[model samples]
Target: MPPHPRTTSPPRARRRLRRALACAVTISGVLLTTAGTGHADPYAAPFPAPSMTPSTLDARYATERRSIEQALRTAHGVGDTGRARTLGAFLRPGRRFLDFDPRGRGQAVEVIGDLASARRVALLVPGADTTLGSFDQRPGKPWSTPGGGARAVYTEASRITPRPGLAVVAWLGYAAPKTLSSDVLTDERAGQGAVALHRFVSGVHRVNPAARIGLLCHSYGSVVCGRAAGSATGGAAWRRVTDIALFGSPGTTAWSASALGAARVWAGRGGTDWMEDVPHVRIFGLGLGPDPVSGRFGARVFDAGPGGHSDYLAPGSPSLRNLTDIALGRPESVTRA
Candidate 1:
């Protein structure tokens, strides 16, 4: 028998093939809409009129609890301590139920502040392995505890000068992946979760019509945001979303921002984060279109300093400072410090 010819694909060709496959997977994972539909009209009536009822609120809470529990179980099975901690925060009584079905698993929006006076509203969407328990830390716990990112951002925003009448919400209202492994990258679970996220944002606007909402999406949460923002259906109300920020984001490109009609798009990635080297490729219907930090996407990229993936919101991290500045409409001077 003739000797089988040795397979000799060059390194460059192999890399190209991998990139192509990744793109295919990403595209297959996300269902793209050709036409815009659900975005709320800019001149629509103010939110929180007769539309939000007590009955609707109750139903939302019940569903959200179930979703959070499911995420916790999944994280524990995968041995993801960070995710488990986050889920623990969600299970807490008051902190987890503050927002209405933000994750689409069914939760009601808990009004923590005076909504009527708020000039700007921010919805903080967390990424992989997120759960209700990840919102705040118990006393005496390490400052490096999980789920501190969102809380830190909220606290920092609260302390900003001329805080712009802001309402910062920690929204763990999406079904995020339990780990960073690529196994779950383009699964339907995440895509369905994205759909739910879109509905939640719209629901929020329906209740708080006049608020200028900003979406702060981190890590894989950026994927959820991209999918939700591009959704023509429930995204109609998002026209009021003045700014969208992504940190340590896996995806958030000009294509997504333009599709979402966001007036401003900002991105930052920590220099030490592995995502800096992650190839920009869509896979199996997963991933956002392109990298926003590539500079070609027109996003206002910022310096996130030396911490890796989770450093964006680290205490005293430049990225977190910049985030507060953008949320408060302050200058970027703090970011340069």
Candidate 2:
């Protein structure tokens, strides 16, 4: 018998095949529509977004907390038991929100550390499978819920930050797609998220013009931030960002680093991250484009170590430390890949 062509495929080809196989399984989920989700999101009238910067951080925290408390009362009165409980838990004792919207999968801007005094602020934008229900609950061990992951990352960053003047915000300001849904296939959802994010960033600038802002975009959240980078409310709002960090990203919908239309862009992927295998192909707008970590794509690459799809923000991980260093504008401290 002729010698078998031992593993004819190159590593890149193998990686693409692996990604294709993985995506094929979930592609069916892409067919599911909002109605097909089997549950409709509860709708609440628009709550005002914080526009004017507060004179004091305490005042802003109080304003946000009062709004959330009121929303909690409303939910309880209207028999929205789930949302009410979620809000109640968040309000218990020592939690703070810069913004809160209970309608449609919930929206919250949660702060960790002292935002008012922090010279550095990092906004953590999460990916899919996140909703009001899973925000605080992360019984899933290693894999965190959107809120859970944000909190985990914040906690981890706080531990590693060299300077005490830093804060992290878990900005769940838009409706996220279910992992098994059509929403993940297109940029439509990201477009909406971009608008919200821009507005939120604007609000942040208003509140703390002097504080340097960094965006930590994770997974599908990278798509949202990519959209926001292009759809800036203005040059000033977009310019306020000191760094745009992407981790475990499928793609950023950008052609290159400059294409992101933002400040310095950084990319990282865990050694075990499945994203490494995903094809950076954009097909009929149903796929991602421009792999951020690829040398040709040209985003500053940072070390993210060996961790799975959900482990980049794992507490005490090098990925989290690298992320904190970038957020703190300590580029010299970052461990580059």
- Please, what is the whole-model Cα lDDT of each candidate in the order they appear? 0.58, 0.76
lDDT of 2 by residue, 144-256 (tens): 55556666666665666555477788888888888677777677888999989988887777777778888999888998988888666455656878899999887877788
The regions of model 2 sitting more than 4 angstroms off are: 1-17, 36-43, 46-50, 56-60, 70-84, 140-143
**lDDT for each residue of candidate 1 in 175-229, tens digit (9 for 90 to 100):** 5655434433553544665676666667667656777777778877777666666
lDDT of 2 at 23: 71
- Model 1: lDDT of residue 280: 58
**lDDT, model 2:** 0.76
Which candidate achieves the best TM-score against the true structure?
Answer: 2
TM-score of each: 0.65, 0.85
In angstroms, what RMSD does candidate 2 have relative to the true structure? 5.3
| Candidate 1 accuracy as TM-score | 0.65
Please report, as a residue range, the 10-residue window in candidate 2 with the lowest summed lDDT. 1-10
> Which segments of candidate 1 are over 4 A away from where they belong?
1-96, 99-112, 132-147, 162-164, 180-184, 233-236, 253-256, 283-288, 330-337
Root-mean-square deviation per candidate: 11.4, 5.3
Q: Give the TM-score of candidate 2.
A: 0.85
